[model samples]
Target: MTITYQINTPLTAKQAADIFISSGIKRPVEDLARIGRMLEHADILVTAWDGDQPVGLARAITDYAYCCYLSDLAVCREYQQQGIGKKLIATLQEHLGEESMLLLLAAPSAIDYYPQIGFEKLTSAFLIPRSK
Candidate 1:
């Protein structure tokens, strides 16, 4: 499959919502508004499209200088393992260039995947809500 990348400026709220949910990245519904805000005001967002439909999204917040946090990355389930995710990350890395620090908090299942995409292990602090 051919993968094409597009830089979106303030992507529709619905697309952002789908990426928040379908990519298996958990976030509260209340956060959708914040995602919209980020879409409106942060670094460029790279989206992969198959025909006219959006199949993948990679969102980042970057200064294009010292640091870039790759916060949300997701591709449709039917589209995994096809190098779409890797291509998205590669595209983001190219945008960030060589000197910037690229970082993300990987989901437990995704720990192995990130390293393969050029991310190294790093110790960081995090907090999660306790299950009732």
Candidate 2:
């Protein structure tokens, strides 16, 4: 299987919104407008394609100096276990270089996976508003 990998920020809001919805990543359609704006501020957005089809996506929001958060990582279910996610993350790290903090919120099932990718468990506190 020949897959193409690219590091680009030209991804459109429609493309991202569609991927998020299709991948069941829990991003609501109502957020697409916000997401579109957010994408503009991203340091990098890497995508994997199978000859024109977007099969995976990984994005980072950063200051490009101090820290970067690896957000919106997803690979279509059928495309999992083929190293797509790893490739995406590795590419992002390359762009980050050294001296930058890479952070992410690991999905419950993926906690163990993050550690394997060089992320140690961090003890930090954050607040989320309760659902109304």
Candidate 3:
């Protein structure tokens, strides 16, 4: 399958929600308003499309210079074992260029996946749990 990857692609809440759910990335999909705002403010959004269908999405918040937080990386369940996820990331890095450092808080299940794609483990990270 030839997936077309695009940077800063505009997506509807339904499109993003469907991708997040199918990819098992646990987001508040039922709340379209919140999801809309999330997508509205993101500085970077990379998406993979199978013609008219969205197969993957990677959303991020960045300054376009020093640091970028890849908040979400999701590929449709059927499309998961392929290189789509890695391609989404590589596209994001390409947009941010070499000087920017890309980071993400991986799902527990994905912790092992990142390192295989050149992400180094970080010991100095911390987060306050999201209360929802």
Candidate 4:
């Protein structure tokens, strides 16, 4: 499959939700408005496309100078293990400044995957649980 990557591409909430569901990412896909807001507020968004279909996505909130929080990374199940996720991350990194540090909270299923892609495993991170 010939995959094409795009940065800051316009994506409808439905398209985002579809990939979330297909990728097995635990997102509120039923809530289109919330999904739209997520897209609206992200400072950076990278997507992997197969022709007209979006097969993967990465969204981040960053200062583009100091730090970048990689808020979401998802690859459709059918596209998983094909390096689409890695390419999406690489595409995002290309947009970041040399001084920027990338960070992300991995889903339980993805804990091992990130390290394989060069993300350091950290024990010092903390989080306040979100109330849905």
Q: Which has the greatest lDDT?
A: 4
TM-score of each: 0.83, 0.84, 0.97, 0.98
Which window of 10 residues has the lowest lDDT sum in candidate 1?
Answer: 23-32
Deviation (Å) of 61 in candidate 4: 0.3
Error of 3 at 129 (Å): 2.0
**Candidate with best TM-score:** 4
For every candidate, C-alpha RMSD to the true structure in Å: 3.1, 2.3, 0.8, 0.6
Can you give the lDDT of residue 97 in candidate 2? 85
After best superposition, candidate 4 residue 76: deviation in angstroms?
A: 0.7
lDDT of 1 by residue, 48-113 (tens): 888766788888888888999887788877778899999888888887898888788888989999
Show model 2 residue runs off by greater than 4 Å.
128-132
Candidate 2 RMSD computed on C-alpha atoms after optimal superposition onto the true structure: 2.3
> How far does residue 123 in candidate 2 sit from its true spot (Å)?
1.6
TM-score of 4: 0.98
Query: Could you tell me the TM-score of candidate 3?
Result: 0.97
lDDT: worst 10-residue window of model 3: 1-10
At residue 37, candidate 3 shows an lDDT of 95
lDDT score for candidate 4 against the true structure: 0.95
Looking at candidate 4, the ten consecutive residues that score lowest on lDDT are 90-99
